[model samples]
Target: MYLAKRLSIQLLVLISVVTQQTTAQPLSNKRLEVSEKHLLTDLITEAISRDEWMDANQLFVSSLQAESIKSGELDNLKLSLGLANMPIDSLDFNQEAMTQLKFSVSQMLPRGDSLALKKETWQQKGQVALVQQYQRAAQIERDVSLTWLAIFEAKQSIALIEANRGLFEQLLEVSQASYSSALGRTSQGDIIKAELELIRLEDRLASLALIEQAKYAQLGHWLGDLESWPEPNSLPQVALKQARFYPADPVHFDDKSHLDNKGHLDEKTQTPNHSITDQTLSKQFVQHPNLIELDEKAQLAQVSMSLAKQAYQPQWGLNASYGYRDDAENGMPRSDFLSLGVTLDMPIFSKTAQDAGVKSKQLALNAIAFEQALALKQMLAKYRVIQSKVAKLNQRHHLYQSSLIPQLKQQEDIFLAAYKSNEGPFSDVIKARIESLNAKIQALVISVALQKQKVEFNYLFATSNDFLLGADLVAPMSSY
Candidate 1:
């Protein structure tokens, strides 16, 4: 009787497990919705809200300006011997000698007064400080934009991978069923391969998740807190939804329309490429903040040279003294005496030192000029490279959207149908699916690259004078 009860219990447990497995639902891609503008606003607001020491570049510049303004006052004249030298007689010896005292004042002035030069030096230094502040602002904008884009790229990659999960599962189901019966077209090896591919996708998703976390941490450093960031899944879904709306070319295969009923690509009118070329970019290069800063630096160096040359000029001074004395032994009081004198320094002996200083300053000015030219050339070269890269990525985008992706999709469908009809190996279907998925992944990579290139151009061109990073305002890469 006990044996019979055990058998009945085992049967019931087996039935329950099979029921759960059969009813289990496949995992679906999570929707991510994000607004670039909103995210940027939040990030910038948080960055500015914090009163950190590192963010005080502008304040430091203001302080330097105040210092320069205060430098207008020169050094005070020397009051030489204001306290008179008094000579006293011996107390016990009682010599008839009378006490005498003397007082004097003196001042030294430059032959070619360089006070103005010194003041100008301070003013130029203030200008340099202001330029440095602007540079810092630009760097901050660059860093923030790069971090934000990195987060976007990682999220998009993970989403693309997730979107293919259903396809992977469907393939796995076919392979499993075919392998179970020797008469089926697919073998156990194909099932194993499908299983491995699924595992690879999961591994890739995990790696992308870690990368996403790191990017969030970097952004949070600027944002002041991680808690303020939206969920990782939220932004990607919005981006994916937008991508779904993006148009792709219609390909005719076997007299059937493979295009999604929801959207269609317009080949006649290409979507405007949001890339900036050297010719189309602003010709007003003078307004670039970096160039402005370098110009100020050069001015500062020139002023320094002028100040150094002032060392060759002579310096002059004046001195005056007064003496009061008591009467002699005859008791006749002596009148107060006054003396005046003038002093001058030709600086003839120090000509070599002054010349050396002037030469040093001149060299510094020349160095800055060379640096400016070199920097400009380098910047132009970088712009050219970035321009070429953007153009190339644009072409690749079209090729993927209009050709490779469509072809792969058709191949996948054909292989899938062939396997179902027992006319092809399941391995072919798996390969087609992987190839199609890879094309999608490649499309995503190019889109993000194009967007990143756009960001670089915006920064390099100084498209916006405002502190806000304009990269956030740009739309995603255009689609056919």
Candidate 2:
């Protein structure tokens, strides 16, 4: 029992120490990058949520409903007057006998099915607008994410380049010192080479900085302000251990390749080895917003056709009124009278017009159906290509991470060690370093491109009612 109590106390002490260490640790670049992604996502969704286009669509829907309501009601209703035997005899004392008065009302009513068809068409149109709005919002979010990734990649290049520049500067100093020393083996040519390399690095840094600025400007265009862009610390860290050399390789120290500023390679490639299948993607293709919008349009055209056919039916109306009339041809008290009317507007004379309208609406519906089918075919083809590309790119990214980068890193370390020991030429070390830098840059570029593919894929596949708006702009990344 005594031992157990002592062990418990020891565990408590360990927990306290760990808590203190954790509290003292600074925020990491990974966490800051996540925060920045969240901020961008929030801004994009907010912009979409407040878009004027959405309001315009909503107003249009309201207008359609209003029109339907107005059409369903009586087209004409009025209080009317009737006068007879007025003022024909001049200077007649009995003018009251020459005057007769009555009051009546008349109205015209719309066809019955016309209002119902309008309501149906309105509903279909509203659905189309809603889907279109969701698609537009998704497009905006996708664009913002792409811009964010671009900026992240630009910043990463700048960091890697700047690190290389520092290395070159140190090497330049060493070469200059060795060249000037009496009895030193380093020649004036080595010093000159180092100076030229340093100058080249400086120029490259300036160019990369400009690229970074342009990327930042693109991000700012979406985010609405350059001043509020996240600080450098909030960017993905390009200096992760992944960018460094691997400690294991069988190569000799004397022979290694160094990377240079010009080692930039195009990173765009296809991905490979995803678990999804074409069959699954095909099943989801019909649910795409563009196709769904087309379906809604078809439904609206069908409703229009129905309304046109309805025009062949007679339009009906009624007029009814109560009248107060003076006694006719007698000096007696007035009597009230109630009158009723029924009017029918038969299409017998305009049957051809109604048939023509029906034909037009039917053609419109057929056109919509054809367009929907075409869109489905096109979307399926497009997604299939994208899937193949993404799969190949995935394979390439794996190759870089698991093979190429580690090999280059080993080469850099080998040349670097030999150069420091003065047993190897400085040029060999620069070559190896440049090669290593190129490998790292290649990895970074491909990583960013993969993320972009993910954004686009999600935009295409997403079908949530809220359309997955305001979600994380990027997946949690460990490094740039």
Candidate 3:
């Protein structure tokens, strides 16, 4: 018994110590990142919980029952038959309660009307819930983008390293050959230069290895598994012909307009028009990633207004209770009667608050209008910027493809031929090779940047049709 008690005490002490360490430990930047991720994960999990395919009819029924329980709204009716109208002994509170119940039932939900209205109300609520689902979906998409961006970048860096590896192999062979030829000809200076080249190649390889390790570490953290990481099969090849860009100008975009910004939001703010999908440029407006949420919210605000008006009106419900009172011939009490009743209390006190609530909801609707305007304005600004960038990149791509790149390729070819014929300095051949590598690398970087910009622009401005296909094209192109 003594030993068990001691052990229990030790366990308690250990738990307390652990708790203290957890609470008192200084928060570092690393811990903050972890906390943020956990919060995000939890929010997504909760939002998904609310997204279960609940039956609207059943939920509305349940919600009405819940409201009855919460507000005690149905049980507030009382009997007031007037003191002179009924003698004290003859006044049966139970009879008055029964009459109130009958009146409330016929007035509130009215038996035959409930089923259809219940279904309709919940269906509208479901749309609002679905809007929340879309926002949640967007968050999940953002997470995926973060993870894949890390992986793509990792693969991209690996490809650069692979390219550098090939450079090293060729450099090593040239150095070895130069060293051999120099020693055979008794040329000490050339041998020294070859040794220096070998040393530089080793340094480059080491640096590339470091970069690969860092990228692997980043990917591992995202996946929540330190031991596993993405193993790229091969470096990606660019398919310039498959590129699809978002509209450059959101102010005057058409069906073929590239995604420049989230301009669809303005359509609704300008007009709370029903059938948002049937409006101008209907295809672009239907379930657009950026605007659907706002439009649904506006619809929900209208529902709230309706609910507020309903709150001002009376409601009906039934109640049953059993009670016992002291009423016995032998001076004792016994169980007497089981009472059943229902009520409809006037909204004399509640109408004021209901009015305030309606006004508050109206203000919220106005706020959403302002928010829609802000989103459109910001999107337009973004669209203009991306358009400028896309134009500049296209111009540069054409200039390099047509003029500079072709001349650089010819120069490399001429230098190779001259070197083979022993008519050019070896250093001149090396310079030509370096220039060509730089040009190719620069071109590759710009091409990737163009795609990255397009992906961001498209995500914010894409039409409903610009979905998975857009993702597919942007996916490979996004590997920065």
Candidate 4:
């Protein structure tokens, strides 16, 4: 009766351990709560607000505004005051000596719309600065999202290992009790194996804890010392913006349709169309802030070239002078003299310098055009690569969800049941449990990877239009 009662207690412990292991579920299935989404948004907003790059860009824009204003008005007008035609001796300061105090003002008129072109160039530069600010914001959003996802992945992985560790501990206790009681098939070897598995779980948890800590440190660059920040509770749901050039079949946060009965993507499943024409991509890229930034730079260069070409025209200056003459020593009144003059400087002798300036500006404009073309091609390539990766990750995630994880769970159950009935080795049961745990962790990894790729894919089409107006980046002048 004592042996029978001891056997019944061991069986109950084994059953409890098996039930706990089998009931463990992956964390990937949990949707990001609304509060969590708001938390992520707030983090992104804080990061952007504190970004020094935005402040630098704003400073540049302000400088450009000052230049635009300077070029638009008579800021270059010159004035002079001096003694003119004064005699060397006081005795010579008579009516015929013509000694006088003179004041003169001269205004150099910019040649052929040059002032307008200069103003336009500065304004275009301001636009580029504004676009760059938007680009910085987009980059910040992507970095923060990726870092947060890394933290989430590490946290989830640690949770899975810890949960499985508890089950392993229970199993270890069962093995030790059974071995001591000389019951079931538990041997000293089984006890050693259970202890080894528990130690491995501990090792894994330590490594993952370090990884989570490192990710938090990286996130601190944007969030500023996460000592007070709560650990991320859920993964943010990265939604792909529906851009016109985006693939027709975008992966969604809850999408499961691509998989078939065999846990594979359906042969008929339409993948992202890699054959999107350059023309279509160009249309989209043209609107992207990156390309728009280059376009503004190119426009600035063109205006600069036009301003340089003005050097070929005559430079004109208008001057007016008023001379107040002192009365003659003999008490005769002296007349106040007014003088007006126009000055012209032709570029006849400066052809070489003028041509060089215009050519340099033209070369810069051409360089900007090449840069823009290269940028477009690079963007297209990146989009295709990210699209393919997202599609493949989706398929892998589905395989784990629809087949691999379920099969592993079943295998674990079969092994546990066999061990319970004395038909399988305890080693098989341990192996099955480890396999199930690893598979769930891998599935969570794939989900995180998929979301990260989607973030990049969406960023390919990110624009400044939404925030540009709000930033008050209007051009200083309407026309050149």
All candidates' lDDT scores? 0.61, 0.60, 0.45, 0.74
What local lDDT score does residue 267 receive in model 2, on the 0 to 100 scale?
Answer: 42
Report the lDDT tens digits of candidate 1 across residue range 65-167: 6776666565567764432433344332112333346677788775464777777788887777655544555555556666766777777777787788778
Error in Å for residue 13 of model 2: 48
Off by over 4 Å in 1: 1-38, 45-54, 69-71, 80-99, 231-283, 326-331, 468-480
> What RMSD does each model have against the real structure?
11.3, 14.4, 15.9, 9.2
* Poorest 10 consecutive residues by lDDT, candidate 1: 249-258
Best by lDDT: 4
Off by over 4 Å in 4: 1-34, 75-90, 95-102, 182-189, 225-231, 243-258, 269-278, 323-336, 466-480
- Give the top-scoring candidate (TM-score): 4
TM-score of 1: 0.75
Candidate 2, residues 398-425, lDDT tens digits: the string is: 6787778888888878877887777777
In candidate 4, residue 394 scores what lDDT?
76
Q: How many residue pairs clash in each candidate?
A: 4, 22, 4, 0
Please provide, for model 3 over 1-480, each residue's C-alpha lDDT reduced to its tens digit, 9 standing for 90 to 100. Answer: 533543554454344323323323344444344342243233223222333332343354356455434443223343322122222565553322222211111223322333333444455555555444344444343443333334444345435545654654574466457557763222345445544543443444344445444544433333333222223343222222112332223322122132224322333223222221222333333345567767767766766666556666665555554333334345444444455666675678876798998898888888878876676666555655655566556545555666667878799889767755666655555556556655665665555556555445544444333222111111111211
lDDT of 4 by residue, 260-292 (tens): 766566675556544567687678768777888
